[model samples]
Target chain A: MTASPTPTDAPPLPWTCPFCALLCDGVALARGETLELRGSDCPKARQALAQQPADTAAATPTIDGRAASLDEALDAAARLLAGATLPLFAGLATDVAGIRSLYALASARDAILDHLLGDAIMASVRPLQDRGVYYTTLAEVRTRADLIVCFGTRPAERYPEFFRRIAPGEPRRREIVFVGTDTDPAAAGPDTELEAVPFAGDAFDTLALLNALAADRALAAPPPGPLAGLAARLQAARYAVIVWEPGASGAQGALVGEAINRLVGTLNARTRAASLALGGSQGGYTANQVVTWLSGLPLRTGLFRDGLRHDPWALATARVLAGRNADLLLWVSSFDPSATPPAADLPTIILGHAAMPPVAGAPQVFIPVATPGIGAAGHLFRLDGGVVVPLVQARDDGLPTVAAIAGAIAQRLAAPASGAGS
Target chain B: MSAPAAVFELRLRALPRFRVDLAGVTPLALGALGEAEAGRVAIRHGNEALALGELFEIRRRPANAPALHFEGDLSRFDRLAWEMEDGEIRVDGPVGHYAAARLRGGLVAVAGDAGGFAACEMAGGELAVAGSVGDFAAAALPGSMDGMRGGTLVVRGDAGARFADRMRRGTAFVFGNAGDFFASRLVAGTIALGGRCGAHPGWAMRRGTLVFAGETPAVPATFVETGHDLRVIWTLLARDLARAGGPFTALPDRRVRRFAGDIAVDGKGEWLLPE
Candidate 1:
């Protein structure tokens, strides 16, 4: 990895901001006391960069709250895993390479795997598995969408750069509608029309009405006027894009996701329409994509002695911990320091961000590791799931990557014990 | 007089800290093995493979009936009688998840409550639970499209959420209340509920009959009331349900109001409410 040039030496280094799911590449970073964003004023990127200070002291590996060498820590973690009956690997917030090595380790240990954002990922995955989906990418929405519908959520609130990233290149007339939410002013443009339609009931009820009207099904009660109009507009548009955030959709989010797909399917029969789900941030998609490709199952799956078993609800991290099914927990969170492992009575091994604070418990192994975009070079899957963004290393923190730490532990487990040397 | 067949009884010696998987210890599977060989059967306790005799005390006795009996709380035991072909498997207490899943032919009777995904993907047989069941009972496995394809599941007590979701072909009778999203996305089946249900029952269902013999539910606007001139069809369905006894025995005597929809998916499923 090439070191970023000094600000006075040359222009800002071109970098991909891995702060959000967008993976914005049209940004430049200048090396200073901290990495500073030069091109974009995205608050999320600024905040993330500020959190990762360049001159910060590196962290060391520890076992049972006492400082230990990397080798000792690896051995301790391997022993815990070797004696475990059922191990759960959760808080998977790392890049592709990190997950690749971890998958091998998990396979050897017969561990259950789940992401920090497993619920959100399943909200989108379950619907696709149950029926199917008509989905769109960011590029398609920017170039082809004439009418965009923001369903139940305002993308700009969580994803700050969503509208700006998909800003149309040429001057063309477009309509933006926010159903069950207030219209976002940031989405307004000179050539774009904006409208906000209040939901007649809750999101579920409103979608049910829209689907019925769009399908031209007769209803005893009159439909909500604005919803009916929007339904007609969706039918008439050249290409419509429905935007939603599955993470914000609440507990029954899978049903909501399925409803959005149903609405998209209803419109596609008459006109062109597709949905754009805005989530999978913090390497959630990276871990999920890697695990799915390596094993035939998605996240929340277990590699058991019998075979691979994927139980989304039963094998959930919280459920597994509550039920005391797993004897050990291996938590990996290399992107964010705040993403700590859930409190459980079982022994834990953490491969986390370099700046992570000490976990308050006994029988724990804490090994601070490198962040993908900040301290190491890696690749991540974008929110849209179609594009893979190459993350450029901005600095060297003298920290090991999650891949290295996990690989080391796996190696220790695979190798037989050595005799004392003379 | 002819001698009676033997019955295999497994009594839990002690409660295990971790969940145990009893997938292959069904009556038909064990009946093929001698008592000594059956004791050597491998079952999963947490991550380790342990012999059946290590966890349970196995005993064989000559009886008039041939069946496999489990005594004690098997709530920590999962996949009981899984894919069982024939013979009877009786659990005196609650059983864990995937109980009798993919059951081809036989009877799995649980005297107590059951865990999630009970009778999932069942092809043929009967799973009768004396107590309530947890979520996704008779529902599809996480990603599979079909659930409880062919069988009869009779739950004597309340059922948890998403009961019979994505069911393709089967008949499920719940003699008590059910949680939300009842019969969701049901493809083809007959589900008869004895008590009240939670929100959004029969959401997105395609082709199935949801019979609510209890109080009328707050119906979704997408459903429209239809003519109730199907006395013959009701009689046939009610007679089959009555055979299960309990709350279903009085089902044929009640008149019903019919509503057709979940047309949100352009579905043809119906909800029958007793009038």
Candidate 2:
């Protein structure tokens, strides 16, 4: 199939936006010659719905820089992987099924596995590993937390509807405090008090001092003079929540997380408190949760014969290429249009978004894959790491999903070398 | 028939974010595999996947002992001997964070300084650092309720901030100075420091032993000085400390003045001062 054949008869289905980790499933989509999205005003969702597969020229898989049939392309990709002594499977940005199939293939080939946001995701994960994390779902924050503190991040920028959806109609309005410089006064619900504690220095020191001061520990220098009141507010609140984004926290981010963990621990000594770490965008949480459940390790894991070995730093696909470690690179990005395969000087195969532009002067294989929520039904985990949302098939984009393509490749790999399947 | 000792050496190339977890890649484990199969051992550096042979130049030789040798500066490498169960890991240079963290069993020796949280949360193992180490050495991992539950961490040089914070059960020996909040929130463990320590020793210690062989540290107000005889415990502990060598070689002969408190939390942890 060179191009996605348009389906004219399928009924309109409620769509799930895979552009972000929220997995907002309330979107209503109208499919036709052109797609239309409604019910959600998120710019990301609109952009995702507007993504159209490239023309026939771009949809066809290319091998050795030449357009080829799907069978020929799959065979070529399989052969490249079969010959590779060490293969790196990176950019795991597809749906749940896709990643599962990919993992099976990687296991069969004993390939190294990772995700595009593995580093960013690991920033949050490292803190979880080093010290433990105290987390509450968005729903709990809405109902329970009387105080909300955002540390070094503005949730509205990333989770656009965070403030509106979280504390919209609480009984006694939740008090909002921003530990960093940024603030959104309007996000504060009616009768809710909003305060900002400006801190633009190293987060490690700030958080550490805050924990000490809050715990009533005597320190020569405490979190700047302004934050002294923070401890009092925390003690007064029935339920307090501290929110932070590991990606935005400056150097010593993990230490900042440690400090937050300590702060929560100290608060729990007397009253109720928890932490809310915000950045789990781009299916990062889904991938991490899935991998953690399956292999008892998160992303950046190497499938060993004995067991899975997780190393957030060492098993990176980028590092593998730069260090000349892996002989083959398999990149998968089947979500957003802008999710393109990273350019690397290695034998590479890309199962990428249809809207991805062709790379210049690279002898890499490119196979355009279908968008999960838009073109096919799929499952994804939300940022909370607990909720799993379903994507209803809204339209027949005629393109193959990453799961299908990966499944095909895995089947081909398992088949006899001279089988008619190839 | 005994399996030959296979030396699995990892030489530093450049620092990567995702640490390499050599949990299952032990000398004993790899020694049984074929040369090619051993070379194909999977490892991750940052978000990249790599084979054992790709990052390090492998030279497997026959020996009687199983050990993993790390050459060159590994200050940026985290989790050097992560969760290691069996074998010996020898580092020639400074190691990074979480070295031998959650280690169940084995001997991890670093010839140079180690980064933060070295030997943290280790259940069973012997981690010896020839040089100073950063904060939280022999302490619990962040979020973990208990720090080093079991194992022995010997730091030849000074320790940084919050040394042995939240330790539950273990023996930590520091030959040099220690930073502030040394032995803070000690749940249960034995820490022997041969040098001066910063403020707030045993801040909220629930139960543990802090042996100071160097300058006298300020005792927290929560602790009450008691002229009691802990001769049996001290003598036995001093003997163990003496066996560790370095400044501890003379620890058994020194007279100890004991003060118990950390009454702020549970008031059970003790501080032993060399008289």
Error of 2 at B82 (Å): 9.4
In angstroms, give how far residue B17 of model 1 lies from its true place: 3.2
**Model 2 CAPRI rating:** incorrect
- Count residue pairs with overlapping backbones in model 2: 28
Query: Which lDDT tens digits does candidate 1 get at residues A1-422?
Result: 55543455566778998878899998988876678898888898888888884643557888998988888888888888887868999998999999999999999888999998888988878888787888999999998899999999888887888888888988888999999899999898879999999987888888888888888988878888899899899989999999988888876788888899998998888789999888888889888899999998899998987789898898889988998899999999988788889999989999988777888874999888888888888999999987999998887777788899888888878877721111
What local lDDT does model 2 show for residue A293?
77
DockQ of 2: 0.11
Native contact share for candidate 2: 0.09
Best by TM-score: 1
For each of the candidates, the C-alpha root-mean-square deviation to the true structure, in angstroms, is 2.6, 8.0
Top lDDT model: 1
Per-residue lDDT, model 1, residue B64, is: 59
Please give the clash total of every predicted structure, in order: 0, 28
Candidate with the greatest DockQ versus the true structure: 1
Per-residue alpha-carbon lDDT of model 2 for A359-418, expressed as tens digits?
764457878887777677888888777888888776666678888888888888888872
